[model samples]
Target: MSLRFADGDFQSAWKELDEPQLDGGWELFTETMGVQIHRLYDEETGLYEYKVFGVLAACTPELCADVYMDLAYRKQWDGYVKELHEKDFDGQKAIYWEVKYPFPLSNRDYVYMRERQDLDMDGRKIWVILAKSSTVTPCMEKSGVLRVKDYKQSVALESDGGCGTKVFMNYFDNPGGMIPPWLVNWAAKSGVPGFLTDMQKACKGYANYCQKK
Candidate 1:
């Protein structure tokens, strides 16, 4: 999917994210990017799926593992929590979670950061996983196959300034192909402004949350 961003806003957001104060707030950082949709309570299936795109700053393998474990246990954070299980994936440990949302919404199950091959060869992939419950419909529910989309991560250091990363997320789908090409283009074009605004608030909120912790 094509992502459109303001000339300098995307880059500016990256700089803001790099601040040293954000060290322990990995979950917040990821959510702030607005790349993933978090279904905290799917009443249909009675499950919750928390999703985000993550980039770890100055993180070690142990820290990464601890983060995942905390997420599984729903440690001290607010918003969403689930009972998590563990498994092995490509030799790395992965965490699985089962969440039961309040009734009326669909219940969705999630397999988070299910350790794929360390794509970057850096011992870990800076990403988060959110799943649609088996009971819930898939992206292409008509077919049995699950469609998995991987986000791209880019990190930049400004030398004289700070260092941070940006995640170029996938665009929303236009299944009908009936929407005018120009209209679709406009939506994609206009979407970035809203995305940037949401991201800024999220990032700042995360930074503050980390400070309190």
Candidate 2:
């Protein structure tokens, strides 16, 4: 499923994503193995607002919470790195940090507990969760192609298929007026194949780190 943002349509898309879908399976999976940050850039104030989400797999709720908290902290630190290393479109530089506590939007305290909640919500839940964290990284005049910026550059574990966790990573870029909706959708969809490949690599590294410790 792909969405396009036109003149007045952009705001409509934003409105369309108001309430979260609350998917049981995705919620379970995310509650088990996902972390995300939703950030917004205010050009007028020159400040950024950030919201974070994370889930960890563990036998006990306490352990899962602990791991999740640690992961959140790690993400905060990683965001610092991203800001430090981020390069602006004009080759200029800017730095910023989170302004609020990372909110927890789920009830599952552990991987086991998540099973109690419906993990088969027909996919609506995951969409809700994703919309909350999704960011629109607009295209830069200097960089003709849309690029995902401020990403933590990590990997993910997959269990749908394959023998082990498949790699996972995310990127977001807004093509702005430069690219039409059709082309933007086409380009965005076209990049998925290669993006997933790189994500797998990052996920593998993360899986290793998680296992080692």
Best by TM-score: 1
Report residue 111 deviation for candidate 1 (angstroms): 4.9
How far out, in Å, is residue 71 in model 2?
9.2
- Residues 130-175 of candidate 1 have per-residue lDDT tens digits of 2122212122222322222322222221222223333323222212
C-alpha TM-score for every candidate? 0.29, 0.26
RMSD of 2: 16.6
Q: What value does the lDDT take at residue 142 in candidate 2?
A: 27
Using alpha carbons, what is the TM-score of model 1? 0.29
Worst 10 residues of 1 by lDDT: 129-138
**Which is the leading candidate under lDDT?**
1
lDDT of 1: 0.33
